[model samples]
Target: MAVVPVRLLLLIVGVVAQYVGITPPNVHPPNEQLREQRGLERSLDLVLVTLRILLWSWAFIEGSILFALSGYCPPAFARPFLHLPTNLTSDPTELTPAFLTGIVLTLAGALLRVSCYRALGKHFTFQLSIRPTHALVTDGVYGIIRHPSYTGFMMHTVGYLFCVLDRQGPIVSVCTGLLDGSGTGHTTVTRVWACVWATGLYLIYALMFGRMNKEDEMLQKNIGEEWRAWVKRVPYRLLPGVY
Candidate 1:
């Protein structure tokens, strides 16, 4: 199997898991309450959710097609979208060591993300809506990081990028190219387009951090000193040593 085909299969599974994991109708907040709390009607909420689902789902499907076409067909067709110099157009990419490792990371991330939700059980909602009856979750994965679930999401995004684009990771995301004798600059990401891809993916991790921060504030407000104590003990937000 080609990396792209494996990518296609994995993406299909991911999209399906995301769909099935969507908060059920029974878990949704009441229409009036939802409007009062979220400043959006139930219908509007549904629309927003539908749009999110469409965007995420379509992105993978579209990426798979583009990767496949680029790998197998004439370079000219996919050249405009591809980096100036790319291995995508060369010999078929099989299950290389890095690609296989990426597969493991992708699956691990998905599992970790899902496990967080399962641990939360009835307390978990797709949106930020919290029940008055809800309790602060600090056991299991939460014990590791304040937001291990988001960490898992980051893993999925990173793994996907690794599996398909095979761009440099976080370090490379911030790294810029230095011009070499070759027309192409010497850098982990050889093209501005590659940098854009890196930026977009990293932005999602930032978004997750923002969400986690807001969640911490909400938890602190609701749970008070106990929440403070948990925060002190856990310390880390996403990464253990970093932030």
Candidate 2:
């Protein structure tokens, strides 16, 4: 069968998995509570969150642009080998077991990501600043992993890449594989560039987390030593025992 159907199938599987509790539940602080708080609800915090949202939105837009541009890109050297035989009837019967498996994985990944975002809600600001509304949430999904959302994000990215590869056939695999093989060459260089970009993103995230921790400390100073004890118990910021 066509790649689109395969992707859809995977997406459906993801949705099912999410409903079945395979994914973490939303655990971010409530928006109303954060808004009502005096320290975290500053005007500057709002602006920062807005800017972060815009930046992430731009990432989505850029992905769309790349997908559109792919139409014009020339086929890779291994295109012939990777190409699916078109002579087969374009019927549902053509849906291979592998394609179905891909569909399930993709769908599960997408659903997990969506659930994560929904759970994060207003707390999902992309800025490197902690607003007054910030709170140290450690219940729900947070109890299991400090940042289950990031885990979900990684899974979603993998699913996305799989979908793209499936749709584009083996040409993508050949090109990417070759690029991977040529050590420190152009492709490898590009991959490193991506890693640098990702590192920068993580650094920004770290800064934001640090800011939040500082805010938490400030609150503890006002609230008393009890808060500090709680922080000590948590240990990790993003990961559990590992971090």
Q: What tens digits encode model 2's per-residue C-alpha lDDT throughout 97-199?
A: 4445545565555565565556656555433234456455556665565555555544543443333333232223234444544322334433554564455
- At residue 193, what lDDT does model 1 achieve? 44
Q: Candidate 1's residue-wise lDDT over 64-139, tens digit each? A: 4446444574666565544433323223234445545666666778787788878887666545656767788888
Best by TM-score: 1
Instruction: Give me candidate 2's TM-score against the actual structure.
Output: 0.39
On the 0 to 100 scale, the lDDT of residue 23 in model 2 is 29
For model 2, the stretches where C-alpha displacement exceeds 4 angstroms are: 1-3, 8-137, 144-203, 206-209
- Please give each candidate's TM-score: 0.61, 0.39
RMSD of 1: 7.4
